[model samples]
Target: MKRGIMLLVVATILWGGNYICGRYLAPALPSNLLNTVRWAISSLLLFGLLSMNHKRLPLFSQWKKFALLGFVGIFAFSTLTYLGLRSISAAQAGMISAGIPIAILLFTPLILKERVKAKAWTGAFLSIIGVVILIRGEHAANGHSSIVGEIEIVLSCIAWGIYTVLGKRFGKTMDPLTMTAGAAVYGTLFSALSCIGTVRLNMIHMTPLAWLSVLYVSTFASVGAYLAWNTGVKIVGAGRAAPYINLLPVWTVIFGILLLRETVSILSVGGGAVTILGAVLASL
Candidate 1:
């Protein structure tokens, strides 16, 4: 249990770094190209790990399901996040991403054909209120905040919610590693297809810092964090592990201030707190 808790903490921390990395890379790299590179590397590593473990690759057998998961989770979610980060502060993006759990809860009914409880509805309401407060506070405090960026982030959250629902529907028989590997493979393909006309090899330029950021996102955030999270969930069970997701935004906020030198207002903090609370409530 203790080991699981530690792993979960590590997962959230790595994922938090993803927001910072995305923010730093947004101006330097095109979103589709970054998404392609990120997932392509991740897919190779994941598949190699699966091969080392002597697991059968599911891509051929479950191509359709993986295609959908890859499109929504990897391509849409990641591309939108990178595009959104181009305009929004990492701190603001972190706060907005706190609504992901609420988005999942709301999506459950529609995607999973499950009925939501009143508490979930209340939690969704609180999440919406918190998002509104966060947006208002961010707009007031930072001139960089963009409504379009915020919308993109919200859409990314929705895409992730749908991905989670669909993953659950399709992945009951598969292990976490296989499921992740399959999705990554198809996601990389989709991202690469999206980059065909727009992305050119000569146009891509990166400093050492940018390369390091890409490595961080592709390895640490994408593969390492996911493996840790899946192992943690297996050990601690999903319900116990769910709360740790709220820590993602908290870690992102810390990294933003320390690494990115981003500022946060009192209202933003308050709003983040409310958003996290709603996630907690919704998970229950």
Candidate 2:
């Protein structure tokens, strides 16, 4: 239980910072390219870690499914998220991305044919309402806010929903480390290819701050967080492990206010509280 709690905290912190880093770094690095770099770095790091354990890469039979999982989870999600941060604050992105658990709850019933409690739907709806309130609150204040940013994040949430379902379907048979490594590798390749025409190679022209932000995200957010989350989750069952998600937006709100100097209204706080309350009840 202690281990699970620690992991949950670590995952949320890394994830929150990832949005901030993307926002800081996006000006210098194109979204797709930034994602590609992080995945490539993470892939190499994970491969080295796995190889040290004398674990050979999974054979061809496992490789194909792993590749697809990586594509959807890493490639699709990261690409859209970084792109979204181009116009949104890291805190705002984190808050918006907080709706992911609700998406997972909704998708599980439809895709896995699992029964959902009424409380779960109520929580999910409340969370969606929270997201709507937060977005409108921010947009009403700024004309420069990009519609594309919200669209990208929303799609990223959908991609993340797909990733979670795929993980549920395939995780039983696949070693998590191997799955992560494979996903990072293939996702990097795909993201790179996707950005071929748009991504600039001249990262040297980027400010030192941007380079540092990229490296931090690649090392800590992408690689360290992934390894930590898998290990932490292993120490706890997924069911008992799930409800920690309710805390993510709270942290995002705190961090956003403290670090980013982002404005938050009473409505956002109310919405976030209601959303988390619903998630907690639903997870119950």
Candidate 3:
């Protein structure tokens, strides 16, 4: 249990760092190309780990399923995140992402035929209110937020929610590592294809810091965090593991201040707190 808790904490921290990395790379790299490189590297590493663990590769017959997962979870979510980060601060991005659980809850009733409780509904309401507060706070603090960026981030969250629902529907028999590895392979393919006409050779000429950010996102944020999260979920069950996600924005805020030297507004903090509370309530 303790080990699981530690792993979850580590996963959240790494994911928080991902927002920082994404923001750092957004200006230097094309979002689509960067996502392609990130997932391509991640897929190779995950494939190597899958082989080392003696896990079966995804079957040819399962291409459609994995492709769907890859498209939504990896391709859409990641690409949109990078595009959004180009305009929004990492702290704002993280706070917006904190509403993903609410998005998932909204999807569950339609996808899984699960009953939505009143508490969850209330939580969703609070999440919306929190987002409004966050947006207003950003505006009040000198128009720091972009409407397009916020829309992209929200869409990314929705895509992720759908991916989670679909994963639950299709991946009941597969282990987490197998599922992640399979999805990543197809996701990398999609990301690479998206970059075909636009990818430039000069784009590969990254500075040391950009290269480091790429390495961190591809390795620790993508593969390592996924492994830790899946293992932690297995040990502690999804319900218990879910709440640890609330720590994501908190960590992102911390990392943004320390690493990115980004300023966070007080109202943004309040909004994040409200969002976290709503997510907690929804999960219960």
Candidate 4:
């Protein structure tokens, strides 16, 4: 349980870093194309890494599991997030993510039949309130977009919750490294098919910084964070592990302010503390 909690916290922190890298690339690259390149690179790297260690691939039946995992977890989550980010304000996205932990908490019991305690529910509630307060001071500043973007972000959140529950189910049958890599393989295929009209390889030109961002996302975000998240879920079940997601925004703010020249407010600091406390209570 302790190890699982630690791994989840680590995964959420890495995911926060992922946001920064992807955000840097957002203006320059189309969302679909960005999904394709990052997943393609991560998939190849994972395959090579597994081959070096003679790691076994999933069986034929298990391929379906991985593919489904890829579809919702990788393809759906990534595509929808980028699509929404294209139009949604950062503040809005941040607020929306506050629901993910609670959604996963509610869905886990229904989808995976996992038992959840009252304490967990309370913790999720507190964390959500913390999230609302955390981003309260940060204004939209300015924005203009249709409701389509809002719908996309909401779907992305639902997809993410499903991914976490499903990942735990898959982890019961296989090691997480193999699960992560397999999902990447299928995600690469899915994203490639989706990129036909969206991503233009002929016009590709990446500067050193852009390339660095890609490397960070493909390696750390795709391979490392996913492996940790899957393993953690397997260890603790989706119910206990879900609250760690609250850490994503906190980590994003910390990393963003430190590396990307973003700002944080005093209220946000209190929110981070409450968020962590809530997570701690839920996991206990």
Task: Name the regions of candidate 2 deviating beyond 4 angstroms.
Answer: 201-205
Error of 1 at 38 (Å): 0.9
True-vs-predicted CA distance for residue 129, candidate 3, Å: 0.5
Error of 3 at 148 (Å): 1.1
Q: Between 2 and 3, whose TM-score is larger? A: 3
Residue pairs in clash, model 2: none
Candidate 1's TM-score reads 0.93
lDDT values for all models: 0.85, 0.74, 0.84, 0.75
Measured by TM-score, how close is model 4 to the native structure?
0.82
The global Cα lDDT (0 to 1) of model 2 is 0.74
Candidate 3 residue lDDT tens string, 1-284: 99989998999899999999998898679998898889899989988998899887864778888888899988999999999999998999898888888877888889878888999889989988888788788878857569899889889988877776666666567777887888888888888899989878776557889999999999999999877876776677554666787788889888988988998788977887898899888879
Model 1: lDDT of residue 87: 94
Model 3 per-residue lDDT at 195? 90
> In model 2, what lDDT does residue 232 have?
55
Q: Which stretches of candidate 3 lie above 4 Å from their native place?
A: 1-3, 201-205, 234-239
Candidate 1 global Cα RMSD:
1.9
Ranking by TM-score: 3, 1, 2, 4
